[model samples]
Target: MIKERLISLDVFRGVTILFMIIVNNPGSWSFIYPPLKHADWNGCTPADLVFPFFIFIMGTAIPFAMPAKTFDNAAFNKIIVRSLRIFCLGLFLNFFSKIELFSLEGIPLLFGRLAITFGVSYALMGNFSLKVKTYLALSIFGILLFLAFSGIEEYREVRIPGVLQRIGIVYFFVSLLYLKTTQKTQLLTASVLLLVYWGIMALVPVPGIGTANFEINTNLAAWLDNELLPGHLWVYTKTWDPEGILSTIPAIASGISGLLIGQLLNRSLPQLEIIKKMVIGGLTITVLGIVWSTIFPINKSLWTSSYVLYTSGLAILCLTVLYYVIDVANYKRWSTLFLIWGVNPMIVFFFSGIIPKVLRMIEFKNPEITAKTINLQDYFYSSCIAPFFNNPMSASLVFAILNVILWSFILWLFYKNKLIFKV
Candidate 1:
């Protein structure tokens, strides 16, 4: 059996993370290519595949991280610590721009979020005669409760469902599911989850909206977000959340699909046999997804069941090719480039978000107009590329690609230094 982590998995994840940064930080949303932008509402795009791909990658990593031992104290402790660390980091990212440094709320808010997430996760991990962990967790919880009722009235949204938070939550459940079940049972559970989600969206009536539908704000998923989340929905769509509650069911399915493939890869089989199975299985799943989409629709925002299968299928196919070429055939020279981002995904993702915001914040007095100020990034783009390219779209693409190159260099340093930032 292969004892090491797959080089192809890391490369696949690196490729996914690279696209994620590019799509997310385009020079101008207005000037983005059609494929770079998310589909207006329903349907999938290259942009739509990144988040689920990350989630799928998370699923594949679980077995390597947790192993097949019973949920012992060590295992429990590891899961809680890692989940809290990741979740708190996410909360801090959401609060980074809004808080004031000297004010009580600034750095403390960041620490407080970390403490709260850590404490909650610790408490859930079972008491192992560790009073310090328990007390710390309680203290964090108490601080959060006080802050909730303090009525400080910040500009941030009430219930911001962050990308990292969703990943953490889905990861927790799916990883736990894998630990508790056999492979056969896991596959069945995933199928049931996808089917149940389909039934709910297709059969259940949306109150006041009448029948179940896939329309923009009229769908079951949107209604659940509006009703359950209320003021916490995505700022872009106050009425609905792309990573909303109801849609998470299918998202979990995407993770399970990856987990299934990961388990397959781990089996005692020849390399060519593994790759052949993945290619054939992926094509079959892809065809089934297409047929199901006739009724359910492969919507990325909604995370429809069809979308889960379709994306997972593509992910499997991609990984198969990468594994065969890079791992089996010993073609690993190019793998180093991808391994940089793949090894330090969270670090790349977090800094990618922070750097752009920092650049945008650093405004300079416009050279052309004394009273006007322009963002540093905008100035660089306008001067360096916009004038050269007649199409703003081309310039925007150049800016995004440049960001990727810059981040790739930064990640390469981390890879060289062996500075992977694991949750």
Candidate 2:
């Protein structure tokens, strides 16, 4: 078994997480830099690369992660459970905001069950004893359940298709492919999926609309999402979801791209040859993606076939450079920061999101403005940051930078103490 960890991969992962945090937590979304914002339609940007990059990295890690190639009942159960947990985590995020913290009007008895339950569960993700973790989680869960039954609240429709949910679905499918198939088979599967997706989008007629088209709302993927998920699509675009059902097929291919890379990385080949092959393959795939984009435009929202290939190729190229610099050439000095983030990504991601929501929850009346209150983020940005910068975009960027720095400091403490959150 190849048990040795790759420093470069960790650094790459850490870099992705760092950028993800920065882009996601901008002080003002309205004032974000072009590179930090997602493409509105059929194009790729630096911001667009983050999710697929992580997905590819995750796929590349799968071969090294699996305990056995042969599928046992235990292994199958473990995989399913892990995928479900990830999905649940995403679902939990959907519910996090809707859970009223201090609201007495609705579900007063069940005051912030999701937050309380999650806080207790998150605490258990540490290096605690199994018994302790289980007992505490169960205790919190029981309390939450009791409170939930005490008061019935109006239900809010949840956004099901999200980054984490897509990741979980991709992981499940790709992990199975990795475990069961040869490298050639995996590659074939990915190619077929991309081709199949392209075909479906190009040819298959949508249900309500007769012709198939890749419009923002009327596309086959979007239509299917609206049909199957209905009220569970993304909140931003109720008509369509970026991580919709049909799009997940190509997303699986993105993961498979990583799995193939994982297989290659694990092989007992010369380091120089590995790097050379990666560069060549990455560039070749990238060109193919670009060529194909002329026919089927590269859209991140649809998780288009071209977009998958484009992002996966870039991910490969990025990893190749990282591997050579950090691993082959033994220049790893600067990677320490990313390594801290890579190891405990889940903790940072979950809490980073929660922290912003927590800030919103902890809002107070603005003394300067009568009959108006402000959130922690808004107040901090306006009072401290916005006043300093002439450009609102600069201030927004600064706020995002500050967020990244805060996480770095927090993660450094975890790294120093060796307190890893396994989930």
Clashes of each: 0, 0
lDDT of 2 by residue, 1-423 (tens): 364678888899999999999889888999999999999999998999999999999998887778457787766765665565555566566667656555453334234654464674465454555455445544543443344344436323566677877887898888888777788899999999999999999999988888989888988999989887776678888888988899999999999988888888888899999899999989988888999999899999989899998999999999999999999999999889999999988788677766787676667778679699887778888899999999999999999999999899999999999978764
Off by over 4 Å in 1: 101-150, 155-159, 369-371
**Which candidate achieves the best lDDT against the true structure?**
2
Error of 1 at 263 (Å): 1.0
- lDDT against the true structure, each candidate: 0.77, 0.82
Clashing pairs in 2: none
Best by TM-score: 2
